[model samples]
Target: MTTPLQPRNTAMFYFQAWISFATAMTAMGIGIAYLPVSAWVRGFIGLGALFLVTSSFTLAKVIRDRQETETMVNRVDQARLEKLLSDHDVFRPETV
Candidate 1:
């Protein structure tokens, strides 16, 4: 069976996603740096921000993986259905 062409991703979508992630991390880092807090507090905030960034990336990857898996399953199901239908005989006389 022939597979359909996937849709093309525009540069704008990538640009926007990158800018948003960068902006969030930058804002958090700057905020942690300038806050008048103790060393431990600053360290905690920095660590938390780092964790957030890492988790966000991980979450995005997981979601993308799940979507790809689902798409593959759907395609497989479609192909199976098409094959079954093609192999079926419609005009054969049925025995009661």
Candidate 2:
């Protein structure tokens, strides 16, 4: 029997990821709000930062979804293999 995959450090992983994302966003927001740069430059920087954060989130979600799909496929394959093995008779006398 194949052992199930256990999600270890899931909470910690998400926590760290969120913390870093928040820190970057907060720093960027503060800089944009307080920096002496021209309005156009500030707007450009803000839009760029927003795009980056949005893309990162979308990429993470896509990766996670792909992993889940792969895992489900693996589980289904395992089940089929187990069923096949169970249906086979190992000790029966063979007749030509």
Best candidate (score: lDDT): 1
After superposition, candidate 2 runs with Cα above 4 Å error = 10-13, 94-96
| TM-score, cand. 2 | 0.82
Encode model 2's per-residue lDDT on 8-95: one tens digit a residue: 7778898998898789888889989887989999999899889988998899899999998998899999999999999888997888
After aligning candidate 2 to the native by TM-score, how far in Å is the CA of 40 from where it should be? 1.5
TM-score per model over all chains: 0.82, 0.82
Clashes of each: 0, 0
Please provide, for model 1 over 1-96, each residue's C-alpha lDDT reduced to its tens digit, 9 standing for 90 to 100: 788999988999999988997898888888999999998999998998888778978998999999999999999999999999988879978879
Backbone clash total for model 2 is 0
TM-score of model 1 vs. true structure: 0.82
Backbone clashes in model 2, listed as residue pairs: none
User: Lowest summed-lDDT stretch of 10 residues in model 2?
Assistant: 1-10
- Residue 89 alpha-carbon offset, candidate 1, angstroms: 2.8
